[model samples]
Target: MNDTTTFKQSLTINLRVIGALLMREIITRYGRHNLGFLWLFLEPMMFTLGVTAIWSYTHANHLGSTLPIAAFTLTGYSTILLWRNMPTRCVSAVIPNLGLMYHRNVVLLDIFVSRIVLEVTAVTASFSTLGILFFSSGLMKAPEDIVPVLIGWMMLAWFGASMSLFVGALGARSEVIEKIWHPISYLTFPLSGAAFMLEWLPAPARAVLIWMPTVNCCEIIRQGFFGPMVHAHYDMSYVAIFNTCLMLLGLAQVRLVAERIAPQ
Candidate 1:
């Protein structure tokens, strides 16, 4: 076979492998129980909605006139739910599924990709459903520009997927990494731009925070959602370049993990 044909066959095989792994992951994680896979969307939806409700109630007296607390909470928390849960879910993905690696078609990268895909899909659905329901119920306005919102969402997903791969690979190589990441993630939460807007922060703080890829993506999403009502600062070029470089690094780490995995 020619080089092109060989590459096509390999790509096709890998895609099939990934598809199978996705199904397996869904089944394994959600199970055939109450709500089944619907929980994928429902779980995150419930979490985001709960947080929004608490924020709306407690902060309403303080934040009522300044911003739309409901919309702000929805957008910010949804971004957090989407991006933050990925690495958590994927950090030890390979360790639990090491036995599956005995199958020739199942590889470490497939396991990592499947988990990331599942997470991104679940959070995206939850975010969209919440947006639509809130808008229709008059609780929040519809997004002013959906194009940038979607681009921002995808960028966050890219960042999440890259981080997941890197963390998952590292976890496979060392037990210490798994323990370390949990606290590290919790510490990073406040800095993730989930609780405040760029405009709310001081100029120097904003300048420093915008360099975080998650913060940049969140700013873009809020800009698209709030439009003139809110001022959001972001540099898409920075987010894109950072995500690309991180993903490349993640792929390299995944390759290293694959080399170390000796299927029993």
Candidate 2:
């Protein structure tokens, strides 16, 4: 076969491999019982709803903000799930699926991609469902601008997927990564801009926190949701540049791990 034909064939096979992996992952994780795969989105939805309820009960929006409490919590917690769950699911991902590596078509990248795709799809579904429910019930308002919300969400997915790939690859080399990551994830949750808007913080703290890509992503999403009612601080170019670098590093690390673990 010519080089072009060979490349096309490989690409087609890899796509099939990824699809199969996705199905297996869903069945294995969700099973075919009560709600089954529906739980994928429902799980995140319930968590977001619970958080919104707690915030409402405690009057978490007492910061002189005009945004609805339901909308604020939904947007904030949904973004948190997008970035947090992906990496958590991906860490030490390869070891559990190592048996599948015996199949020529199943690659390490496929495993990570399948998990990341699953998490992103689940979180996005949860966000959309809750948004619709809240709007209908008059608990939240329709977003002022959906374009930025979509852009911000896509950026967050990229950030999460890249970070998961890097973390998962490194995890194959050492178990310590998984241990260290748990605490770090918890510690960073408050600063991730999921619980508050950038405008709520003083100038000095806001300046430092804006450096986190997830924080910028939350700001972009909130800007879309609340519009001029809130001041959103973010630099899209900076986010794009950081995501690019991280993605490159992740791909390189995955390649290294694949070589190391390749069957003799």
Candidate 3:
């Protein structure tokens, strides 16, 4: 058979395996309820609203200073939530599914890619549907600049995929390392540049977080959604380089581990 035929057969086989796994994951999380998919949207919306309530209480004048409140908070919160979910989802990707490695056709990369697909499917739909509703209903306004928001989401997705794959490999190799990850994840938040706009950060602090790739992603997202008044002082070139390194390292580590962890 030609390479095309081989790839087609491979994809067809891979799709069956992946499809079954995806369905199991969805059912496991959402159950057989009518609102299964709806739950995904509700989950993020609820989290955003909870955070917004606190934000409004503490900083009553947040969006009043610039953009529309609902839109600003929804987009920002959803973007952060999307990036944050990836690592956690991936940590489970390689470990819990370790048994799948037994089959010659099933690879570790398959699991990682599957998790990424799941996150993307849920988040893209959730964000897009809610975003449109908010925009059309006059609950939120369009950004003065669209490019930044699109760039921001793409960057976040790439960074999330890269880091999660890397971190997932490390976590799979060592439980002790996984233990340490929780504290680090908690610490990353203050520096995450998630809840607040980058323009709000003071000079030196801004200098630091802006250089951090994920933070830069957040900055790009806010600039896209919020207009000229909103800004994130990130270095895009730095993030691109950082993600490249992480992707290579992650893929290498996975290859090394897959052989060792292959199920009987």
Candidate 4:
């Protein structure tokens, strides 16, 4: 076969492999239980809603005049659910599926990508449903600009997928990586722009925190959600450059891991 035809055939086979992996992952993770795959969306929604209720109740008097605590908490926590849970899901993905590698078309990259796709889809659906529910119930206003919100959501998903790939590969190579990532992921939660907004932070802190891609994404999302009512600070260029570099590094790591796992 010619080079172009070869490439196309390989691409088609890989796509089929990825699709099969996705279905297997969904069945493995969320089997035909109570809600089955529906739990994928409900799980995150429940977490966000629970937190929002507690925050709204306790801080009933303290929620700012500008943005309702429900709206703020929902936006921030939903984004957290999107980016935070991914690495956790992917950290041990390859080890359990190592036997599947015997199949010529099933590679390490396919395993990681399938898990990441599952996570991003779940969180996006959860976020969309919550936004609709909150707006219709009069708990929050509809977003002024959905385009930027979606762009920001995509950026966060990119960050999560890249981070998961990098960490998942490392975890497969070393038990130490798996141990360290658990604590590290917890520590990152507070600093991940989930609990507060960029405008609420002090000037010096804001300058430093904006360096986190998650923070920039949260700010961009809030800018769209709140519109003129609140000021949000973010740099899309920085997010783009950082996620791109991280994605490249992640792909390299996945390639290395794949080399180690290649059949003799």
lDDT of 2 by residue, 1-264 (tens): 899999999999999999999999999999999899999999999999999999889887646886899999988999999999988998878888989999988899999999999999999999999999999999988999999999999999999999998998998889999999889888999999998888888999999999999999999998999898888999989999999999999999999999889543
Query: Which stretches of candidate 1 lie above 4 Å from their native place?
Result: 59-65
> What local lDDT score does residue 186 receive in model 3, on the 0 to 100 scale?
70
Estimate the TM-score of every prediction: 0.95, 0.96, 0.88, 0.95
Model 3 residue 123 lDDT score:
79
For residues 57-150, write the lDDT of model 4, one tens digit per residue. 7875333555788788877998998888889888888778988999978888999998898899999998999888998999988888998899
Best by lDDT: 2
lDDT of 3 by residue, 1-264 (tens): 899999999899999878767776778778888888567567776777777667656764553465666776777677767877777777756767777777777788778877777886777677777778778878777776888878878888888888788888887888776677677877787677766666776787777667678788877777777666665577788888988998999899888877678574
Error of 3 at 47 (Å): 1.0
Relative to the true structure, candidate 4 has a C-alpha RMSD (angstroms) of 1.7
Global fold similarity of model 1 (TM-score): 0.95
Q: Model 1, poorest ten-residue lDDT window?
A: 59-68
Model 3 / residue 143 / CA error / Å:
2.4
Q: Decide which is better by TM-score, 2 or 3.
A: 2
Q: Tell me the tens digit of each residue's lDDT in model 1 across 174-241.
A: 98988999999989989998877778888999889988998988888888988887778889998889
Candidate 4: residue 199 lDDT (0-100) = 84
Query: Model 1 Cα displacement at 209 (Å)?
Result: 1.0
The lDDT of model 3 is 0.76
